[model samples]
Target: MKKATRLLTPALGVGLVFGAMGVSAQSETVTVESGDTYWGIAQGFDGVTTEDLVEANEYNPRAIPIGAEIKIPDGETSSDNDVVTHVIQPGNTLTNIAAVYDGVTVDDLFRLNPGIDPYSLTVGSEIVVVDYNSEFGEDYLYHTVQPGNTFNEIASVYDGVTVDDLLEANPNEDPYELTIGSRIVIPLN
Candidate 1:
């Protein structure tokens, strides 16, 4: 009887573990549309970050082809409190838009609103101001370099971020010889 009890206990524990895994593994797929970015899609769902969507699909966030089907992890719902959007006004740059919000930076704007041309501000276009539920913390955010990405371009996207700051955070990485798919740290000022 003792031997049977021991075996049953371990088997029951294993069953419960597998059951939980099955529940968490639930996910749904969505087709990528024109002008759809990973960050933009994540905004439609609450508690889901661009990183989550990217990691789940294992695709380059910067170059997701249109009409491609991607997996969106299930169980996350939309929450209005988690994200806020701002409509661009005349003379509004990412810098000035970020300035209007406390603790929001150009880096945050770039991360939240990917694929936006910093030099071209379309008046009346809406962009995400802040994603309070982002997996990244307040002090810094991590960025991965894509093909044809330059240190200067990366620095230019984030307001007030200089190549020097990126160098300081990443001591071993050479800004001039940035490697594809290498991670860079962008420190928030």
Candidate 2:
């Protein structure tokens, strides 16, 4: 029974990996820290929703585990850099701001900016928008920790990535227990 139970985990994990690969979208994982909220974490990037963060980590919004890595999905983006930092200015509407980018939207502004109200925009607040499929940019991505995540578990989903790679990439993180919603770098294949 113990053997079967152990095998089931890996089997299901493989299925998940394959299933994820079948989709057109890919994800980066990140670790959660103390006092971090879904709303706060989602604010760090453009187009990342609190619901998406919750769904990816598979945790309750109220009680997310510290050290768990969460997956942040990327949409259509392209740039030489992983992200473009845009400062919110006076007279900026979320729709108008998002209109400047192909995949960005008013919802994206809300997702990436939790404290600020769309109706009353704040000037000088920085918002980060991620660029997907950027040419010759940072190969590794920043991943958020979610429940039931380990270096091995995360690596199992990606092609040609390993626990050792994760360790090497993120020497600061404890390999045994990753911090939930904390940032971990994932090396690309």
Candidate 2 is scored at a TM of 0.32
Task: Summarize candidate 2's per-residue lDDT along 99-132 as a digit string, tens digits.
Answer: 5443456665565566766777668775654333
Best candidate, lDDT? 1
For model 1, the stretches where C-alpha displacement exceeds 4 angstroms are: 1-26, 75-163, 170-189
Whole-model lDDT, model 2 = 0.60
Q: What is the lDDT of residue 146 in candidate 2?
A: 78
Which 10-residue span in candidate 2 carries the lowest summed lDDT?
1-10
Highest TM-score among the candidates is held by which one?
A: 1
